[model samples]
Structure formats: C-alpha cells, structure tokens
Target: MYNLRRFILKHHFVILFILLEVISILLLARSQNFHRNRLVSGTNVVVGNIHEMGSDVGGYFHLRQANKQLAEENALLRKQISVVTDTATNTYTLLDHDTIYEYIPARVVNNSTGMANNYIVINKGKVDGIKRDMGVISSEGIVGVVTDVSLHYASVMSLLHSKSFVGVRFKNSQQLASLRWNTGNYRFGMVEDIPTHVELHKGDTVLTSSYSFIFPEDMMVGTVEDPSVSSTDALNKAEIRFATNFATLRHVYVIHNLHKPELDSLKANFLDK
Candidate 1:
C-alpha cells in the first residue's frame, strides 16, 4: 500500500495529463459541430462494419439451409415442366396436365468413383420417401438409381457401376440406346444396343428415354465425347462423357413416379402380354 501510494504520487502527473487529454477531446467533440458530426459518423461506420461482419458470419452458417431451400425450389420447377410436348410444333399438349414425377431434394453423404461398381449414399431414405429403384439426378444430369434404403439414408447405383443400365436417347435424333459403364472410367460411359451403322456426333447430348419407367423423359444423361480425342473407346464404340461428375457429386434429387405402381405392374407382365 505504501509502495502504491509512492508510485501514484510519482506518476500522478502523467495520469492527470491522460485524463485531461480525454476530457479535452470529449469537450472539443461536443462543443464543435464539425467534430461532433465526425465523431458520430465514425461511430456509425464502426457499428455498421461490426453489424456487417456479424451478418456475414451468420450467413455462412446458414448456407446449408439456403442450399436445401434452393434444391426444393428447383424440384418444384421441374415438376411444373413435366408435360408432353410436340416436337414438331414446339408446343406442349396438356391432355391431362398431370405431373408424373415428384422430385425430392437430397444431399450426397457418401460417394465412390474409383471402383468397378461404384455407389453413392444420400442423406435421405424411406423416411424421406426414398425407395429402391427410384431414379436420382442432379441439376446437371442423371446421377443414379436407389438400390438400398434405410430410415435416414439410401444407397445408389451410380452410372460408374459396371452393371448400370440406363435407357438414353440422342437429343436430336431420339435414337434410343442403353447407357453402361464398362471401361472403369467414371467420367465416360458406353451406350450399347445402338445400331452399328448409327453414327454418333461429337458433343451430341443423350437424355433419358421415355421407354424407362424409372426416370422421366428428357432428363440429361451424358454427351458423346469426340472419338478422335478419346483413347478409351471399346471396339471402336464412341465414348460418352457423363453429364454428372461423380468425383464432385454432391446435391441430388430422387425421382418418384406418380404412376410407377400402375406402370411397373403392367411392365412386369410384358412377357405375358
């Protein structure tokens, strides 16, 4: 206590000077209109910057929620376009105007592309109306099909799988073919069952065929890669670059066919018919 008193007595002048300087600044700011305005403006700027920083941090944390909302909106828009169109007239003929496919937005929880039979796992399952045989796709293109389902998760057979078979048609010619991955490449696939005389053009896009009940018609699947630049062609078969990038697969949508039950039941008895 005695040392503290001695120290204060020794440095009281400095402390006093600091206090007086603060008081002088405050007085000058309060009395002078210019100084006061400057001070208020400075304070407002500081406050605004702090608020902006806080808002940026908050937005960063809510990105997932925002993405989910966007996915939902995209799904709704897709449903609105589920119509039968006349290619000759460029017009849609609404016979019943009934939506056939219902889209459920989901996120990829797990994915594999470096294997012969790759698969993808999504963050939704039976609880989210996901079921086996349901088609999966992304905004870019067709992804895969659901194979297994749990309460909160589901597994998908991606196009990279050796057994993957998807009915696809050339966007321009509407020539039907079956898409498969046999070259063990995730970026490219093979379209089989196409006639040997049929020539595939470079950059020609292939979309889901109406023949498949699993996927809606006209869903993008892949594009025919330039054969001259590709060395992975099988038996001179043209290589197709997949629309969906499996390595960076993330958000996806599960396709639920509204008339799947009736369509599938009838399809099941096709041999009998």
Candidate 2:
C-alpha cells in the first residue's frame, strides 16, 4: 500500500495529464457527430482487423483436419456422382466392376512432370487396399494409374507419361477416342482415333470411355484444345487441355475394383491361351 501510494504520488502529474487528454478527446468526439462517427468507425476497424487475424490463425491450425474432411467428402461425392450417372450411358456399357468399386482417398507425396515417363507417388498403399492398375483421379479430372505399391506408399504412372494411353469419349457424339501424351508439355495431350463424322468443337470436354478398364466410365478427362501440330499422320486427332494439372496435384483418389482379380484370372486363362 505504501509503495503504491508513493508510485502514484510520483507519477500523479503524468497520470493527470493523460487522463485529461483522454477526457478532452472524448468530450470533443461527443460534441461533434462527425468525430464521434469517426471514432466508432476507427474502433470497429481495429476490432475487425483483430478478429480477422484471429480467424486466420485458427484456420491455419485447422488446415490438416479440413483437408482430411475434404478428402473424405470428395470420395463420397465422386462415388455418388458415378452411381447417379453410370446408368445414363448411350451406347457404352458400364462394366460390372464399375458398380462394384470403392474410392480410397490419398495425398500426392511426390510428383514429377518434366520427364518422358513422369510418375507420381501417393500416400496410400497395399495396407489401405490400394493395388496395382487402380485408377487415380483428382477433383478436376482423371490423374493416373497405380503401377506400384508398398506398405504405405504407391507409385502412379502419370497421364503425362509417353506410354500412357487412356480411352476417352467425346461429348459431341459419345464416340470413343484414344488419349495419349506425346507433347512434352504436361498441360496438353493428343486425342486420336476420333471418328471423322463426329465433329469436335474447340473446348469440347472429353470424358472417360465406358470401355475404360482402369478408370470409371464417363469421368471427365479434359477439354479439347487447338489443332495438334505434332499430329502429322492421317488419323483424326486433336490436342486437348488436360483437366488435372500434374504440377499442382496434391490430393487424389484410388479406385478399388473388387472384380479385378477375377477378371485378371479370366484373361490369363482364356485370353492368353
């Protein structure tokens, strides 16, 4: 109590001056409508900034949880979409395994798009029921196919690979085309074997064909781009802008085909013979 009194006495003039300044400012603000409004708005701005900063900090901490939640939701939503659209095919037949499959959400741990044989590494593996030849896709479109698997990781053959070829259907006539990556540019691919009568418009979207053994039928692949400079052959072909950007791939889904083993066995026994 004695120390407090001494401190107060020593700084009494400074304390009085500060209090008077504050009181005068308050009085002036109260006297002027414009000043009062300015003071309130200034306080509101400061408070709003503080709240925004707090919200940003909180959101940064919850990003991982939010991503996991989004991955789960993505898988569920894609599956639902497939189920809803699988039966609306025109001439293409949806395979039996197409209806008997599940989606395993994964994260791209590593990716390379600058090579002739680009590959992507995902965080799901055999333990998570991820096997070889499973189709991988992103929110935007088809990504790749699982080529190798381990206990906790798997390698995917990216669509940008030189040898990668996917069967795609055009939106104009539902006619099938072969999607192959030969352009060194990762953003574009070549669509071949399109029927000459089926006119392809620029920016027309292409989708996974019903004959796709790896990916689900009717999934988006990309939009048709400009005429292909590299395609010099006589076949009807065009360039397409790939929907999934390989350079920015982060999250993906691995498709689980329940009848793959049976199909493989049948192929081995009958087709091979």
Can you write out model 2's per-residue Cα lDDT over 214-233, one digit (the tens) per residue?
98888889999974434445
Per-residue lDDT for 138 in model 1? 85
User: What is the Cα-based lDDT of residue 67 in candidate 2?
Assistant: 81
Best by lDDT: 2
Cα lDDT, model 1, residue 179: 84
Model 1 ranges with Cα > 4 A deviation:
1-97, 227-236
Worst window of 10 by summed lDDT in candidate 1: 34-43
Give the per-residue lDDT digits (tens) of candidate 1, residues 1-273: 999999989999998999999998987556333122323322233443454455456556657865875687679777665532224245544444477888998877567799887767676767789878999998778998887766666778888877788888988877887888987888899877666556678999989999998889999898998544333434345678998878766668999998999987887899577
Show where candidate 2 strays beyond 4 Å: 1-99, 227-232
Q: Point out the worst 10-residue segment of candidate 2 by lDDT.
A: 34-43
